[model samples]
Target: MLIRLIYASRAKSLGPMDVKDILESSRRNNTAAGVTGALCLSNGVFLQCLEGDRVVVNALYHRILLDPRHDNPAILDFEEIIHRQFGAWSMGLVSTVADNQALFLKYSTGAQFDPYQMRPQALRAFFTELMGNTRWLA
Candidate 1:
């Protein structure tokens, strides 16, 4: 069965090259595993959605949880889905190069980047908006 796993984590010292490296690595790994997702890094937080087989997505999430590049990893939404929202991407990414604060404010109530406080549907909506936004196109 297919599943969608959404999680948020604090961002580390993620520079341009670091973001590039992450995107490349994720693209490669996820493509091989038949996973597709979009990753958004904004205001010191990362919001990502992984869609694939339950076992593969679960394993990938576990590896992500162990990665030391970020901390405070929290799973926001995890459920079986009939279709992939991010089917066009192996691992599409949006980093903090743009105005992250504004982006966060656009989707959230406050200026702070506390995605864990958002309701599941709201978070998914935010992800959908981000995925469709031209600025976040990858």
Candidate 2:
């Protein structure tokens, strides 16, 4: 059955480029594993949603837990959503904002640097934005 999984993690203090490298690697690996999802990182927190067979989703989670860049990772949203915000990505698609701002919001712009407070609405908005950016073309 198709399942939707969402998880978040705190970064040790990775810069934008470092975050990009990690996300890029994840995208490549997730694609190879036949999983699909949208990923977002901001305020040192990562938000990701994976959709696929239960086995694949769980496997992906396991792999993430092994990554050193993250710590105290938490499963935020795991229920099945009625519809997918991302319909095109295969494996994964990742986006990052380097500040206290979110990927989604009234500003729709995020801080390029510095640690920002993690407000609930801003973070959620960012995750939603990541979902909205799903690559149907892929």
Candidate with top lDDT is 1
- In model 2, which regions exceed 4 Å deviation? 13-17, 81-83, 91-130, 133-138
* The 10-residue segment with the lowest total lDDT in model 1: 95-104
Residue 107, model 2, lDDT: 34
Tens digit per residue, CA lDDT, model 1, 51-112: 99999999999998887788899899999899999898999876565544565667686767
TM-score for predicted model 1 compared with the true structure:
0.89
lDDT of 2 by residue, 88-112 (tens): 6654435343332333344334444
Which pairs of residues collide in model 2?
35-91, 100-116
Native-to-model Cα distance after best TM-score fit, residue 92 in candidate 2, in Å: 5.8
In candidate 1 the C-alpha lDDT for residue 18 amounts to: 75
lDDT score, candidate 1, position 22: 81
- Per-candidate TM vs. native? 0.89, 0.64
Q: List the residue pairs that clash in candidate 1.
A: none
The true-versus-predicted C-alpha distance at residue 66 of model 2, in Å, is 1.3
